[model samples]
Target chain A: MIINVRELLPFLIPLIIFQLLLMISALTMIVKQRRFKYLNRVAWIIIVVVFNIVGPVLYFVMERK
Target chain B: MNQISALFKKEAVESIRNFKLFLLLAVFIIIGIISPLTAYLMPDIMAMVMKDAGIKFELPVVTAVDSYVQFFGNMNQLGLPILVIVTGSILTNEFSRNTLINLLTKGLKRHNVMLVKFLYTILMWTVVYVFGAVTAYLYTIYYWENELENILAAFGLTWLYGIFLISVIMMASAIFRTSFLGVLFTVLGVVIIMIIASIYPMTAEYLPQYLLTSNMSLLTGETGMSDVMPAVLITAGASILIFLLSIVTFNKAVM
Candidate 1:
């Protein structure tokens, strides 16, 4: 079974775009914030950057004061 | 009326500023995209995994039903919890921050506050759910070129289940002082309903939990409209009743 990367690009692009958008927004919020609820700035940056979709969502849902 | 609109506007602005609106929309859109994408890619994924394992197998045909199943499953498992967690603190935040004190003193009716929050949350859920559902539907159609059965009823049932979740959150927030507890109880309430459905089976037709469980069957025409009508009616009624009860509880709640 040969899977063509080019053929899959259109299907994959939106997932990547939405994910990156989410990550960017979450990072922006983390950088702007002086205080966080559960963890420090660097930790959240790592989580938001590392976990793809769930990372930013966890930060937004859990870290907001 | 004026007070309700004012409260609604405040809710909107606050959610926007806090990134709650954006987070909810983004997560839901991703869920929407992932459902059909996963369904469409399942066979390829299976083949890739199987090839590495030195296993020979025939892949089951994936259809539009698989996409719908993924949509409902993801919505129920991932989407609802996120909705609850994100909006769970709607009332508790005001309570903890002491923001409602000034509004209450300024002659804002307690019921109006509850009503606006409920309406706003429902509106958000509806918009996000529709966006996710439509995306899945379009992608599924693009891949399969087949029409699904009972599309309206299937989607509408899931939407109503979402409304039921929002109402649960509303009631839980009204009853619990902390956002964590509010969210916990909302999830627990649904789990309990699920348990009841499983344990009794006889009552499954009338329980709100039936809404989420029956979607695949509804989509495949295995479940008829008349079969789900009771659950649908009960869910709609339960939502309204629970919301009104929440308003009552909110009225008596300490600010």
Candidate 2:
């Protein structure tokens, strides 16, 4: 299975981690009451998942408010 | 005009007052000096270690290009990270400490604040880069004679690529309210650029990462100026765009 998904090695794990990080950040924002809008958070979640390091880092910076 | 000059003077004074920056410059200068020195001494160093371990080894002839390659490798990984740690909190730190209030209240526009910050970062970067380059260049030429070709193009591309990295750090600093976030974002940008560039061989020459890779070829005339011009232009252009974007977004964001 490792070799079966060999070509996908880089993307899968990174993407998963990125997703988790995004979720945690978004939930933190929600709990803090800084963000009350769901659509904006969801849009950011999608972006963070797709662009790997750049997206997540950007989210970590840009969407903090 | 006075605002611009005042801002420049203020940043210059701030950088000088921060004694830690002097230490950082010393470290980078040492790295530059030691890199060429190491490449020159690797054979003896390796032989001593290997002999102590009951092993024999033969080392290949090292050239000036090897020293230059060492410079690129070290600067990209170590020196750059130090830069991030040092300058990632420029405006952010000001905001956190409320120091920016005085400056802004003195009639300095928000956009001008961002521009000055970026300019000062670039200015510091240029000073450090020239110090490192001069150290390595003098050392390399003193020991080994390199057959010169497009040396100007080679050096320019390498430095311009470095400018690209500085721009990323500045933009990330603007976007992130904290220093750690700025470092994270800038590093993330580099990694993503490398990964995407790796997907296609044709893109390798144009990627910001290629600046270090093609240094020797560009210097030796093995590659022409036309090959490197695109990459330099792209890196420089992207840097300007990122800086402008950061200024616009930062100006809009309510602090």
Candidate 3:
């Protein structure tokens, strides 16, 4: 049941990069905006950066001005 | 036509500036990428888990079609709601910002405004949809090489459902002055359709909701064109009717 990391790198790398990009963008916007209707900016930033893919997506869809 | 074009430009710019386009494409592309990757890695992941539990089982060889099934499943469960949330505020945002009143007083036709919004939202959906579909197609090709059966029909049915969903959202936003109510109505509309589909097995054949649920089967050839054509027609017809209704309601709605 050993999986080769090399064979999977092509897919894994892109997925990780896309996820990180989303996370970073969400965090940066949270810091810069500093205002949200529902949650405080600090909570929003923590949620966006900490939960990986779903976190950033939740922030964008349900949050953000 | 000129008025419609002008409003469409406005809608396009608003979508871009608000980051809806970027967020949607990013989410969909991630769905596209992860679906196939999950399918490709399923066997190894399961084997490792089973080894730890001292259990053994035979797993079916995953194919390109399996990836597509996964892709469509994600589209149904995750992608559709994301689509709803992104476009749910189309009209309500204008209402809240008082832009709708400004534009109405400036001689913008109500029906034209609704039509333009519908058109632009669909256009964005199409672009991101293609991006996601192509990404999934390329990765599936790389991992498991094979041509999918009824590929066009599968995509077409799902694409029609997306259009239907957007129309429903548009109608909801048009009728409701608040973005939250718009989203609520849209979700309620979908839930009612789903509930009816489940309650009456006979009517499921004609329900548009069937298209979303059965897309994977169509790709796998377990479902035929004959099975889906009725649902497809009903979906397309319902969408058009909803669109027309939205226009009429929007015209009369107090800004």
Worst 10 residues of 3 chain B by lDDT: B177-186
Q: What DockQ results do all the predictions give, each relative to the true complex?
A: 0.72, 0.02, 0.64
lDDT string for model 1 (B20-124, tens) is: 888888888899899987887789989999889999978889998998888898998898888888888888788777888998998999989889999999999
> Model 3, range B1-255, lDDT digits (tens) per residue?
899878888888888887889888888888889999889888888888888999987988999888998899898888877887777777777787787787789888888888888988899989888888888989998888887678878877778888988888878887776676656666667768676766688887788888877778887889888988889989899999999998888878877
Among all windows of ten consecutive residues in candidate 2 chain B, which has the lowest summed lDDT?
B18-27
Clash pairs (backbone) in predicted model 2: none
Where does candidate 2 stray beyond 4 Å?
A1-65, B49-58
Q: Residue B69 lDDT in model 2?
A: 76
All candidates: CA RMSD (Å):
1.6, 13.9, 1.7
Instruction: Provide all candidates' interface root-mean-square deviations.
Output: 1.5, 15.9, 1.6
Off by over 4 Å in 3: A62-65, B52-54
How does candidate 2 fare on TM-score? 0.73
> Which candidate number would show the highest lDDT if scored against the true structure?
1
What TM-scores do the predictions have? 0.95, 0.73, 0.94
* TM-scores of chain B, in order: 0.94, 0.89, 0.94
Which of the numbered candidates is closest to the native, going by highest DockQ? 1
